[model samples]
Target chain A: MKKVLLSTLLVSLLAACAGQDVKDQPQAAVEDRAAAQTQAGADAKPTGQQSVTANPLKDPSNILSKRSVYYDLDKSDVKAEYKPMVEAHSKYLTSHKDAKVAVQGNTDERGSHEYNIALGNRRADSVKNMMNVYGVPNSQIETVSFGEEKPRATCHDESCWKENRRSDIVYQGE
Target chain B: MIFRKLLVGAAWLLLAPLAHAALTIEIVGSGANQIPISVVPFAGENALPQGITAVIAADLQRSGLFKIVDPAGVRPEPHELAEVNYPDWRTRGADALAVGSALPRSDGKLEVRFRLLDAVKQAQLDAYSYVIDRAQTRATAHKIADLIYEKLTGDVGVFSTRIAYIVKSRSHYELQVADADGYGAQTVLASKEPIISPSWSPNGAKLAYVSFERKKPIIYVQSLVSSQRQVLAQFKGNNSAPAWSPDGKQLAIVLTKDGSSQIYLINADGSGVKRLSYSSGIDTEPSFSPDGAAIIFTSDRGGSPQIYRMSVSGSGAQRLTFEGNYNVSPRFSPDGKSFTFIQRVSGSSFHVALQDLASGQMQVLTDTRMDEAPSFAPNGKMLLYATEIGGRGVLAAVSSDGRVKQRLSTQAGDVREPEWGPLLKN
Candidate 1:
């Protein structure tokens, strides 16, 4: 029972730092896994393993799986660390022109409802603009701002506010 | 961002009241001077449908301006001019005394008579009577309290006004209307989708709000009398933030149909649609001045959301607020001298602020971390808004001068988006 409590506490502590580390740790782990898979010879693959091969969109070991891009308070500017994730999604969209994506803008619950909607729109549009610069057409991207209607964290302090101010990339049929 | 996908299916729960409970107003603070008033038990009150004197006492007590003396069984209940006991109330430290009675009429109605007396002078101040049906006893009690409050304070009382707000419990969202004291709550509309921005019409007959029932936000104007609603604006994309014009002839709404969210003017019956604002960024939350000459709204054209004013025709657009990096939801006072909105300084939270339009001076009214959607009382005595308390949404009110404060909360669920309706015309 004591070990269970300690593990739970440690997991929550790590989850508390997940927002900052989300930009770095997940992509790094994905890269290491991809390199290990390449080091193993392709001819040694077992039978019926083709069905288990991960699709990049649904794969937990790909950068495309990381969707959220965090921002500063009341800011719509995407950070430099999130550029690789956004670039990966842009590349996927450019290769798969038939695919469509929706970018949702969000903000912390700080100001008026309408103002947050505008802020959310700006955040979503910022992601769309970056995708466009990386060769994704406007026709393939739809942007909407949920404002502060949905919150990632229902807290009133800075730690929760930082988690709420973000733009998310959602693919078709997601 | 990943939370958005998870909230899609889990957000809308089965639409039902978590509990059929009435909102109770909690007086968090009060003014320094409290008027001492004694309300002796009304004679023959038990025979009536509702307690007459108890309603009157509660109406006065909730205003945060009057203090009700218990009387403690020391004073006898009196109903007429012949029953006189002025010295009893005077010695009990009551500045004023009220005595009343409820008598049944032959037509199955009730007549309530009340007399206000000056305890020290031992003279009657005023006397009146109201003939009402059994169902109108609560309203009559509020009217009598309004009369007494005006007679003492020389200011129009808001006890007779009504309030409309949105209450959310889990996945169920309800738009509720209640008395100014947070009693007699009636759910006007309920749906599985989110409902927001309840704005009252000029005469308090209808409310224009945005609902997301159809998978997208659409504005609807609902009548309180019939429980019937009309789709005012269901444009191509994102119709929201409906504000009624002063004359009740038009509505200033925000629509993203024109590629970006901009203010538009349409007839109250959803006709003669015309675009009112032409901004590159978002322009929304359009509120009219009391006289209806100009409209005030929040716009991000200046890089950050700020309050901007423009004529009814959408020309002469000028920014009104410049104190902070963030300001939105500007609502003009009834007299059109000042306006209130949410202002964010160099901090992590937003506070409700009052700004004088003539002098461009501002005063922060609340100390809470997050406050929004301020609606002024019809009499211009107080302003109601939504704020967070222990992670739950609740409604709060403060006097226009920022002296007295009160919290109106429910037993369960999150109560928010409070709009104080205008005093209905007789």
Candidate 2:
């Protein structure tokens, strides 16, 4: 009897998966095609020599790879320590006209939810202002504040709060 | 779906005293003068179908204006004022005494009568009677209590009012409503996603809140009686912070669809969409003044979060607070003379503060380390807000004069965003 019940459960689970494939299969195929086209483009570049066109955002050693900049409590000013990281991303955005980025501002969970929304937006705007001063076009950058809704840490302490208060730089289609 | 099951499992208790005590209210402060009163058990209670005297006593005790002297053993049951037992209650330090009786009718109804007496003068103060069924017994008790409270305190009692709040545990979030004294809690809506910002309609029939069920913040107006809800705002971007206008004809919401967060007004039926405020920085948390003349909100236009006021037509933009570097969540008092907001001092902690609109003078009310969402009671006598106690979120009430403080906490998890409902006509 136990074996019969187990088999029945396994068959039902497989049937559920088959039903899901009807809705998700086409999207998965489209994603696979896009991945294959990107691979083909990379292969078309000459081999045996270093490729001239390389996205710095994907380069491990480039400062543009650093995506997040931390801020102090209730403060939106970009800290001195994260200046180099912000500058590098600003330089990349100004040079690459097609590049578009979204600066998402966040805050620690210590205040009202809606107030944190405003504070988070200020932090994101601070980053966008710095990038604009560095010659990044206004159309290439967008700012949004998630407030304290999306916290990086769950611990209720200063160290965790420091990690949660940050602005993340996200590149388009990365 | 979870709420439907929980509602069935709630074991609706109409007459019996609450069995499951989810939140315990700890009175930390009290007024100086409390009128001492003794409420004797009602006679012929077999037909009452509910604890009439006990509910009345609990309602009076919750006001913090009356001290209850137990008459369980010290006094005898007297059905009328002519019984002449005022000497015994006076000796027990009770300035006033209440006696009542419930008689059964042949039509399966109850005739409840009560009399209030002045123990000092040995004279009758008031007497009333009502014919109600079993289902209306609890409401009758609350009504009797409100009458007694008004006769003594010269102010209407909020015993019959309702309170709405959000309760979150693990991944389950439920919007629960209870009596003003935090008893007889009933779930309004439950979901695995988060729920916040519960604003009651002026008529106390519906609620406006933010639900994240669709993986994005959406504003919903839900009816209190039935579980029916309507999507008031579901624009492309974030739609949050829904505040109902006093007339119940409009709602002020914060929407991010127009590039940045800004305040917008929509009809109660979700028809008209009109932008209200214009600012480069984030403009959100819009609260209407009591008279519906202007709106007070938080904006970062001046470098940091500060409270700003704008007319109903979005013209007379002016700053309201300059004492603190961080201020947000401004809610006007019921009389429109003052407002309350959360003010943070130099990154130390957040406190609830009240500012007079005319004088511009501010006074801090709470000493909690992290306080948010201060809402005024409908009577304008007390304020209800959310605070953290020992790393757990709890709801608390403090008098407007800053004299009385009480903590309302559940057994586990967090309870936040308490909005006191309006007084309904009985």
Candidate 3:
């Protein structure tokens, strides 16, 4: 449980600049994983499966680890930079026939809630469409828009709003 | 073990009633032409559960239409029409006087007699008397206030109506139905998840709202009286934005089951679902017109979100709003000549705006930023909406002409998605 949460946090922190080679990228990445591990309060259990059979979805080096794609204000389109990441997930879905995913679309805390709901629905559908483009079967994907209900960040300014306009892909039973 | 269990059960029952009636109201922006009136303390009304004159006065004052002149030193509270001393009220600068009395009847019921008098003309304007049960005190007071408001303002009164809103605290979300005055709130549904888009049935008996209790939006219709609820829509994907048609037999709901958040019409019993909109882009927030012949909804088919009108027969839709790139939540007035919607003035500042259908004139009703869920009072005299004040979500009502304003909020939690229920029929 601790490793999974730490990996999720690490992936979210790297969503914006995952492939970049910044001077402090590896150091900050290690620090965030360490902090999240301490908060989870559990250490590695020396499982031999972590070496050759680690879940690719949780491996920080893999693009599949990044689940969220942030959008512009009131926008539902997956940006050009995020397309490679979304296509990677779509390829994963196509390969894993039994894996089902729900794309949860979210929005910033602005505009009418009902309109935002529709906007978020479009966002989720956009991801589903991208998956369909990669030959992912319709039965493997579903969409739900949380609108502005579940925010990644709570502050009312643009800093938080920018982080909140997002769509997250979740595999079932994970 | 049974004794301890019974004590905990009793404690929960004791605290249940305390959780209700938390919504309080504050009136601001007085009417430019407020009528001066004095509502005297009703004789024997102090013995009842609710203050008759106080409720009446509050209802009138909250509208920003009437001022309650203090009757502190009026000698001998008037109980009958003959004893109302109009000249004394005229000297107190009151143009009208409301007097009443409540007494126990022979069969242990209560009898309430009320009268409205014109101070300048020195004549009784309206009189009403009712034999009611103790449970009907507050409603009867609101009815009397409604009668007084109608007699003076020449418009129907909505004081006897109810409003439904979602209250979000840290622990859970509660859908509450309260009096129009924000009193006597009763929770209709509570869940650990979100509840939104509360739509009142045309007859005012049921509320059709979307709840995210099962990790997805599903439409449900719950009886305000019996508390019995059933799912109206639970399709393959998200089913949300339930709206009642004027006839009450069918509902217009938005569904993503077919993809792209299209609008659909379904029986109120959750059967006979038929697709109503087929736009390529997102189309949602469906609101029915007063005559049920048309539906006004938000659609992005024309490249941006705007209000559009379509025939209920699933015909082609015509866009209705052209002023803003973002216009949604279109609610028709009771008379159907105009609609109230949320218009994004610019980046992030959304205001409640009204548009007349005949002439393309639009009127913005509020200066408050972040306004949503605008529902007209049954009479179309006021628009009740959800807005953020000091970063706390609260319910607010703006007069149709944007002259008067008031706020209703709970001591704890954020309130949003307010839908004012209709003036119920007996």
Candidate 4:
């Protein structure tokens, strides 16, 4: 009985994908949303930048592969340690016009839901602004705040919270 | 097809067996003055699926204002005024006596007649008769509880009202509307993505909430009856924190298209967007006053997030909280005399706190840590909020006086973002 119930829930979860039934506005066909495959495509060949794109971003040795910037509690400023990584990704995106990045911000559950949303927005915007300073176009970047909803770590203490309060630069189609 | 199936499944709660994940409520701490009341089982209620007296007694007990005088194996249950049971109830220390009967007629309607009497004085306090559909047996019992609540304490009861909250189980989220007692929950919207910040329209016909299904935060207003929804705000950047005006004609939403998270006002139909706050920092979580003349929101304009109030015309901005550096999510009471918000105590833990507007006095209502989304009941007597209990999320309630705490737990995953719906209109 439990297995049947689980299977029914799984089928319903798969069937009720967003926008197929719920969305009212006609979703624009502006950009491709195959973010899951963007990494594989971008890693095959060198995207125009010099050393950053010379190797696959999936390569453990490349700094361009480092896409996350962690923040302090209740803070949104991008830290100095992640500047080189941001600049490397910025160089790669600026060199390749079609290489879009969606900077997603997250937070610990310490703050209110909506407040974390606002704070996460600031965190993502802070990274996007840094990339723009490195000569990336504003049009090439999209920022979304998960706002403690999508946490990388689940523990209630600071050890997990330190990992949750951060932003990730996700390449389009990846 | 899943949405259709869900619609059918959600509709089953009206008359079918209770859902598997039904909520169980636990109460602690009684009100300052507890009135002992005896609720005799309605004479013909045994024939119905549920006894009306049980629901009424549970409602009154959950409020922490009344103590139940359990009548077990008592013969000749009082069904009318001439039952002459005041002496029996008075000896049992019951100050008030409630007697009623439910009789189903041939027309398929249940005639519910009830009376509340002063047991000590042996006088009739109030009597009511409601003929409703059979499916409304539980609802009518709640109405009777409300009637009895008003008659005895002079304060309105919130048993008959509904509350909307988000229940997150695994990767899926369900927006559910349930009775104020945490029973009879019906899923309004189910999704795999996160849905938060549900704000009910003034009349309780519609709900405005932020959905992240679009991969970005967007505001949508959905009708409770039709299950149809419209994108209220799909602007560039973060579009979230949708709050309805008291008149339901306009909505206060937070948008980032203007460079930062700032509050903006738009019509109910998603037209006429107007920015109301200008802060280089963050400004979100807009809550309207009961009169809809002003809005109180959380802003970091003073270098730390604090509650601030501004008029609807975008004038007369003033800071309201000076105690905590992290006070956020402010909601005004029904009477607008005070507001409830989450205040971080000593910069460590969060607790639901009430603030008085006239004297600027603040009192923490909940002892639990990590309390957020403090929504006042329609009567301004209790507050519903989200808190973490034993590492699992649950919904809790605390009376405005800081007494009468309750824990409303679901058998399944966490329930968060509980908003008490307005009193329903006939």
Maximum-DockQ candidate: 4
lDDT of 2 at A119: 73
Q: For each candidate, what is the lDDT?
A: 0.77, 0.76, 0.80, 0.81
Which lDDT tens digits does candidate 1 get at residues B1-426?
Answer: 111121211112212222212212122334557778888777778877668789899888877778898876663466665676877776777877888787788987776777777676666766766667787778777777886676666667777789999898876789999988888999998765568899999988899998766544689999998978889999865788999999999999988776678999999999988999998988988889999999999988998889999999999999989988889899999998889998886675778889998999989988877788998988677899998888898999887778768887754788888899987664
lDDT of 3 by residue, B128-206 (tens): 6777777778878887788777777767788888999999997478999999989999999877667899999998999
On residues B80-107, what C-alpha lDDT tens digit does candidate 4 reach at each position?
8887567788778888888878998798
Model 1 spans > 4 angstroms off: A1-55, A94-97, A134-137, B1-33, B120-123
Please tell me which predicted candidate would have the highest lDDT against the true structure: 4
Task: Give residue B44's error in model 2 in angstroms.
Answer: 4.3
TM-score of 3: 0.86
TM-score (2 decimals) of chain A in model 1: 0.71
DockQ of each: 0.22, 0.22, 0.32, 0.33
| Tens digits of per-residue lDDT for model 2, B228-263 | 778899985578888999999999998877756899
Per-candidate TM vs. native? 0.82, 0.78, 0.86, 0.87
Q: How displaced is residue A107 in candidate 2, in Å?
A: 1.3
Model 1 reproduces a share of the real contacts of 0.40
Query: Model 3 segments beyond 4 Å from truth?
Result: A1-52, B1-30
After TM-score superposition, the amount by which residue B22's alpha carbon in candidate 1 deviates from its true location, in angstroms, is 40
What is the two-chain DockQ of model 2? Answer: 0.22
